[model samples]
Target: MSIASAIVLFMVIWFMTFLIVIPFRIDTQGDLGEIVPGTHAGSPQNHHLKKKAWITTGITLVLWVIIGGTIVSGVISVRDIDLFGRMGPEGSMWHSESGSAAE
Candidate 1:
């Protein structure tokens, strides 16, 4: 993938992980029986956002490395996942199978 694509992929992964981790180990007002007079019961008393963000970053980094490496190394390619056969027959200028550009 290009540099821009790699960055985009990382951002997407990070945000996804953040969303999934947000509710974990949370201390909601209702759960802790400390609901403020003006606040809803479901409101968080201690969200630990900073800690969750760091945890998300760590998880996303590991996922990005494995996914990015697969893309860069071409283990699973676009054509391989083409469900409707949109890419047509595979052809490359640099063919590793025959070790020649022109057959």
Candidate 2:
């Protein structure tokens, strides 16, 4: 993969991780208040859940950054030439053995 492609892939992974983990962070009063119906406010279980969510979000963000940075930088060293044999010789579909002229 090229640097640009790797960057795009990293962005996609980062975006997906953000979308999945953002809902878990209880950084606001509204998030804390969205518990089960009739549940007591400021309960131990609620606080624990919020803490766990924040931790998970932090871990995910850290991992995403580390992995994405490594992947993007690694891809930067890749050559621009195509490694696959898709271009054929001289940019023509027919081989020399076929004795076919370029159309």
What's each prediction's TM-score?
A: 0.84, 0.32
lDDT of each residue in 1-103, candidate 1, tens digit only: 9999999999999999999999899899999998899999999999999999999999999999999999999999888887986554577535454356465
**Total backbone collisions, model 2:** 0
Model 1, global lDDT: 0.90
On TM-score, the leading prediction is 1
**Model 2 agreement with the true structure over 1-103: per-residue lDDT tens digits:** 4678756765676567656665553344344565555655443333355555555667666776777676556754333354864445655656455466663
Top candidate, metric lDDT: 1
Clashing pairs in 2: none
**lDDT of each candidate versus the true structure:** 0.90, 0.57
lDDT of 2 at 13: 62
